[model samples]
Target: MPMSEEAKALRRVYQREYRRTHPEQLKRQRECTRQWQRQHPEKCREYQRRYWERKAAQENK
Candidate 1:
């Protein structure tokens, strides 16, 4: 199901607050992501390709 605008806004606010209050956790998570990307370059590239495609599609709308 698609999220309503209000739900999306609330999620954005919550995520922003979480990031602001959890710098160390976020740093560790980023480090883990980087390590995983290094260990799976092809998977990372495929994920990035899909991300950019979705971003471009959104912008074109």
Candidate 2:
């Protein structure tokens, strides 16, 4: 089921609060993602390709 607008808003608020309170953790997570992408460049390119494709399709709609 799709999330209601109120639920989505609440989620955004919670996420913003969490990030504000956990800067170190978020920084570590981003570093880990960067490391993974560096170790898997091909996989990352494939993922980006699919992501852009989906984004383009959404915009066309």
Candidate 3:
């Protein structure tokens, strides 16, 4: 089903708010993740394992 006009307007407001607040946080998170992956491959593997576990659960549902 298509989104209603009110839903679309709300999405626009939410998108703008998120862009203002989240870009720096996301950039920092990416930098930290990359540093972790570089410094500790084993720790990165554990993160990947949990990521796949979550993906599997979502797919099953």
Candidate 4:
């Protein structure tokens, strides 16, 4: 997998120099995630769901 221009630009915008040193496969995954979050609100909703689930679980603990 390769990083798209959008992801490269995002990395620069966010000052994520660490992504440069990371393996490209992980970078590609992050890039895909970023793109999906930009293009799909439902994906973000899923993220929110997982977030609340983790939070609820931690609170229960």
For each candidate in turn, give its C-alpha RMSD to the true structure in angstroms.
Answer: 2.7, 1.3, 5.9, 12.1
C-alpha lDDT (0 to 100) for residue 37 of candidate 2: 93
Question: Measured by TM-score, how close is model 4 to the native structure?
Answer: 0.41
TM-score, candidate number 2: 0.87
1-61: candidate 1 lDDT, tens digit per residue: 9999999999999999999999999999999989998999999899989999999999999
The candidate scoring highest on TM-score is 2
- Write out the backbone clash pairs for model 2: none
Clashing residue pairs in candidate 1 are none
TM-scores across all candidates? 0.74, 0.87, 0.43, 0.41
Q: Model 2 off-target regions past 4 Å? A: 59-61
* Superposed Cα deviation of residue 15, candidate 3 (Å): 10
Scored by lDDT, the top model is 2
**Candidate closer to the true structure by lDDT (higher is better), 1 or 2:** 2
Candidates 1 and 4 compared: the better one by TM-score is 1
Error of 1 at 53 (Å): 6.1
Off by over 4 Å in 4: 1-22, 57-61
lDDT of 3 by residue, 1-61 (tens): 9999999999999989998989998799899978978999998889889999999999999
Q: Candidate 2 lDDT, tens digit per residue, 1-61?
A: 9999999999999999999999999999999999999999999999999999999999999
**Candidate 4: clashing pairs of residues:** none
Native-referenced Cα lDDT, model 1: 0.97
The 10-residue segment of model 1 with minimum total lDDT is 29-38
